[model samples]
Target: MNGMSRIVKKVTQLLVSIIFMYGVYIVTHGHLTPGGGFAGGAIIVGAFALIILAYGSDALKLHKEEAGSSASESLSILMVLILAVIGFFVGGMVFFNNYLPTGVVGELISAGTVPLYNIFIGMEVAAALLTIFIALVIFKEESK
Candidate 1:
């Protein structure tokens, strides 16, 4: 009653998972590919936005999602900071010094700590974006 047509809702439901997976793939293979945390996170948030647009904010539980996304953003940033500090300590006070071993040239696990950074950054970006979207939705509703 609060959203689009049934066909739109069904299509959104089907595409959301695929979009999320593609985003994850982009983030994971960022070192090897062009897409990275920021791009992938934006892609993931597109799925969230699509769901809200197709099914309404209530269907997505905006408040709960906002809280969860905020928490995830915080946790991910903290983790990134911790990783940077650890890198600094382990690499003779050099910040973000890739201390982990680089396996192969074109392999999945070749980049070592870079992949971890990408993952954490992806989480942070995605959560931040979702939180922003939720806040915008709530603000729009309140203003009306």
Candidate 2:
């Protein structure tokens, strides 16, 4: 049983790592293309979920029981709010105004606020998923 579990863990971990990298790529290229924060972030968590399923709770540890995740979630929300407030002062009272420069078309710093917004959304999604995982893990443990 132990050997079987170890093998399964390794396979699932490899798959999760691959999908996580792919999600990062997609989020980075969000504004330039279609897939944005919500999609890419969800993909990342989906990969992580697969890993958690195959492995155990120990593999998902980040330090102090989901500390990084909670912090990251707050940071992302803060950033989004800050940007919106900046928009109020800079880009008039419009909906998600393109405050920053649009830059070139296919560049890293293009798409004005789109990329930034996508990044925050991605962070939030990733953190939220981690929180959910932690909650579920605790709930199951308590039930056991």
Best by TM-score: 1
**CA lDDT of each prediction against the hidden true structure:** 0.92, 0.81
Model 1 over residues 17-121: C-alpha lDDT tens digits? 999999999999999999989999999899889988998888877778888999999999999999999999997879998999999889999887999999999
TM-score of 1: 0.96
lDDT of 2 by residue, 1-144 (tens): 322377787787567778999999889899878898999988888886776677666666634658878888999999998888888888678756788877888888887888888989998998898788878878877898
Error of 1 at 67 (Å): 1.1
Mark the 10 consecutive residues where model 1 has the least summed lDDT.
Answer: 56-65
Q: Clash pairs of candidate 2? A: none
Clashes of 1: 0
| Model 2 regions more than 4 Å off | 1-4
